[model samples]
Target chain A: MMRQEAMGVLARANLEELRGALGAWPEPPDAESLRGPEAGLIMLRGRAGGGGAPFNLGEATVARATVRLSSGEVGFSCVLGRDLEKARLAALFDALWQREAEVVDMHLLTLVRERLAGQIERTAEETAATRVNFFTMIRGEDE
Target chain B: MYVAVKGGERAIRNAHRLLADKRRGPRNLPDITLEQIASQLALSVDRIMAEGSLYDRDLAALAMKQARGDLIEAIFLVRAYRTTAPRFGFSEPIDTSKMSIERRVSATFKDLPGGQLLGSTFDYTHRLLDPTLQGAEIEQAARADVTDEDRPMPRVTDLLAHEELIEGDGEAEEGAEVGDLTREPLSFPAERDLRLQTLARGDEGFLLGLGYSTQRGYSRTHPFVGEIRVGMVEVEIEIPELGFTVSIGEIQVTECQMVTQFQGSAKAPPQFTRGYGLVFGQGERKAMAMSLVDRALRAREFGEDVVAPAQDEEFVLSHSDNVQSTGFVEHLKLPHYVDFQAELDLVRRMRREYEDRTADEGKEAAE
Candidate 1:
């Protein structure tokens, strides 16, 4: 079996182009149609239990763009928050990310991931500070 | 408002709110601390950590608290947490030989080195409740205060090795030879690494029942607990960039080795057999049960016929994990409306065809 390291490189590269090839909102995707929440969920983390340690607060709301290739494979990319430009970029990549797309190259895909990663980092600073929540302990009868 | 069945989103949100409210039943009560669960409910946390394949006592405790004492749910929480946590590096293979033993015992010998320190076992304890624990004056036992430096532990394997009774020679299996269970789907006729990996994270109850079944005349093999060891082992990680091994942390582990009596064959010498088991934390019953099942799984090695259910590797390993079993079972409750609608349409068509065939036969007879 091929080590996981090889598979990771393939998935990341494929996903970027796959997410980018998806174009504008007017053009409906050819295959792999979906009807669900446009905004995806991203888990934001906070200090674990009020200075006790670090842990996940909960899923943060984010706008995601998804599109399917002509061959019926779907790709998805979620941004930090509701950035329409980011969502469009994600959509374009989603449309072109597949191996069969034959239009985008690996070099372009790498550039897309780097660009997306940068955009995400910038937007994350603003959104991360706002939605911090700590779950109160839920009591049971035995307690 | 002529909308047709459009309030599902609102209804789902409201239902979640109600569930949250119900989860927090009474606000007046004092909160249960993670320490309390870690100390008092240690067994449940141990099982959770074992099945979840992540050994964080505090997180396991939190999972238990969140799960409302359901160990399986706690295990699920721990598993979810495990998935999200980024993998920094791999830990060094724990040296069971150098384990700082807390509870050690052996059934193979009447006496052995390091002495069978029955140390903190519930085996001899009466089932009767101690009313003193319920009193307000409940205090930590004096024995609890004893430090690790005061008493050192020696492995039971060392004793067996000392006498040369056990087969102690096997090449160290390289890490590259082992398959990663978490990353890939398991295939049939798995290697010992994959099998042991699955059993290590398998559900306690499932393994226990399967292990028990073997004792009830299913490929019966007279087994003895050659050794049972429990203690903390330091987790080490090799840094490729740094070119050295570094200690990450420590985790409590329970290890069991069972020696089964195997009859001699024409080609091979008759000798005592071995079955190995290891689990996170102090779970003797699970470890012992695992050891028995592990041995049973090695039926092919002994040239024995695979007539028993426990001897079937697929049956034993596949069903041993509660998380996988329960998840697949419960996933049936998810939206299957599409599949159900298709089935319904097929059944209606079949009935119509059957009625038409019977009518044609009657018409032919009349003609």
Candidate 2:
């Protein structure tokens, strides 16, 4: 998979999910923290008319981290909410993926994508079930 | 007037202590957990988060609990925390078109492309309180039926715009400077961007009342609900080195599009003007009210006179922030002893002078 796609999957993964995905690895890689696993805020933006000029809607808490591996690959994580551990683990996984794409894709990206798809599928099915089946009444006849 | 009095330190300390005790209520009752507040009283948290202009669910829940369920106070707490929190950057504008909609319905069209899916709404339910819910153990929800046909959910406005039936062309100005009210102070004749930012975090009751005023013919807008969708949308941000937008995560949002009637001129045909509202969570009432106020505010854009408070941008935008309103109003609770003492002395002196003048006039009359 592409780097952006891989990063997107990693960023969306939660702390427990990211931790569970790490179990597939043989051992932790030689990674050093290049930057902090610090919590911060990101202002989420929206459009004026949902399709017009952009404006600030609100801010969401985010935790980010950057890691550099012995192999000279740099990994970064920027996920929603303030979970420093999740950011650190995701950064480490990014580094691991740069070296071993196949292994990471096989265990992590595929699973995350499938889980996301499953959620959308579930919501879509449930939403469709509640589709309104209404009967139109003639206004003058009713009157 | 500038006299500073001391000796309230001990009173203040004891007041806080009393407040803490009161917050706990009875010692026998268990403390309400943040998780419980976040889940059980979710709408309250949603309001707090939206009005506070912060989107951390857990923090909002904590604020609610700390404020003892006073939602406005909770919003104030969250707003205070937002100022101290470090800001990373702004995400790209969220696309509601590709939203994974959970609840979507249109009042204008009955059989629109996306069928009206009433996803977890309280619209049709009887308002009577369910006493059984006090200690109810709910059963598992029924499984949804599997479907292979993937129906595309298009915006109702987009459909009308295809035939040139709406005011907005539905095309955003490319490379336009996005306004951030935090970065700069909002000024007069504010564009739609700044107006949207203010309305997004504006007080629900204020907007609701203003919107209702428009309905009561204050600034009549024959409005129809084009669509209202509650769903999850992906938030993407561009990384400097990556050279591509990366999805941070999904956020639940509520969106409403209101269409109002506009008459055609001699050269132009009549078209439906649009108003938009988008909030952080499942804030349906806020969204609806915001859309109404938004359309009314567009009176000037449509060459109509701004005769109502809702149509007046300055009035709506200036007093919309409940935090600011609360600060100015609630500050009356603070000590104003010196100011009041000055008024007291002035009134006494005025009364003495008036009595002296009246006594002189009485003596002259007697003579």
Candidate 3:
């Protein structure tokens, strides 16, 4: 998978999910924080009219980190909300993915994707029931 | 002699203890967790997020819980917390067309592509409260099997734009600066961009009242709910080090596109106009109200008479923030002994002068 796809999934992965996926390696590769597991705010922007000029909507708390493996690979991850541990783990995962994409995909990336996909599917299914069952209020007025 | 009042420290401490007791609401009952407030009281969290100008649901929930469910106080808490965080770069403008929609509806069309989905709304429900819901174990909610196809839900306004029956959005120039209310104060006759930013964080009730005024013939906007969609949209920001954009997880948003009937102008032909609103959660009511006020405020742009309070940009923008309004209004409850004494002394001197003048007039009349 591409780096963009990998980072998106890693950022979304929960702490439990990341830790569970980390269990794959008998002994994890040592990673050091190159930048931050620091939490901050990312101002979110929106279009004026859904598709127009952008305006600042609000800000969301985000935690971002950069981790470099002892070898050479460096990875960066920025995720929504302020879970510093999650940010650090995501960064580590990103670095690992750069080194071994095939292994990370098998253990972590696919798991997060499948879980999120399932959630979206469940919601879409539930919402499908609510589609308006419309019939004409007046027979001639339907025209 | 000027005197200072003191010794509210003990009273203030005791008052806080009482407030804590009230927030907990009897030790016999389990306390409401922040998680529960985040999820179960989701609407309150949404309102707090919109008004607080922050998008963290967990923080919003904690604020709500701490403020004992007083939403204005909750929003204040969130705003206070927001000031401490460092600024990361703003995200790319969200594409609502790509939203993973939960609810989509339009009053303008009965049958349209991607039929209306009224996902989890209170609109049609009987207002009668169900007593069984009080501590009753809830059963399985209604669900249906859906096709795996992820169909593109085209906006109704987009279709109208194709026929040239509606005024196009007049999309902003790509490199144009969008206004930031938090960063800069608004000047008079502010552009549409700044107005939208203000409305997004403006008090929902204030917007609601203004929107209602228009319908009551204060502004007289013939509005039709062109579309209202509640869903999640991906947010992406460019990282300087990476030299590319990465998706930050999605945020749930509500967007309303209101179509208002427009009369033909001397220079332009009559076409439907648009009022838009997008808020940080399932804030349909807020979105709709915002849209109404937005259109009303756009009266000057359309060369229509700006006769309404909503149409007055200064009036709307000046008083939109509840936090600012509440702070100034509530400050009256604070000690103002010096101010009161000054006013009292002035009034006493004025009365004494009036009596002395009256006595002199009586003496002159006796002479």
Worst 10 residues of 1 chain B by lDDT: B141-150
The TM-score between candidate 2 and the true structure equals: 0.95
lDDT of 3 at B244: 86
Better candidate by TM-score, 1 or 2: 2
- Give candidate 2 regions above 4 Å deviation: A140-143, B1-4, B146-151, B357-367
True contacts kept of each: 0.00, 0.72, 0.80
Q: Estimate, for each residue in B100-130, the C-alpha lDDT of model 2 and write its tens digit.
A: 8888989889888767888888999999999
Provide per-model DockQ scores.
Answer: 0.01, 0.70, 0.80
Winner on TM-score (1 vs 3): 3
Which DockQ-derived CAPRI band holds candidate 3? high
Lowest lDDT block of 10, candidate 2 chain B:
B141-150
Q: Write the per-residue lDDT of candidate 2 for residues A53-75, one digit (tens) a residue.
A: 78889899999999999999999
lDDT of 3 by residue, A20-92 (tens): 8888765888988899999999999988777777888889999999999998899898999999999999999
Residue pairs in steric clash, candidate 3?
none
Pairs clashing within candidate 2: none
- Using lDDT as the measure, the top candidate is 3
Per-residue lDDT tens digits for candidate 3, residues B67-86, read 99999999999889998889
* Model 1, span B262-337: residue lDDT tens: 6577875566666777887889998888788878887886778898888899988888878888888887776676
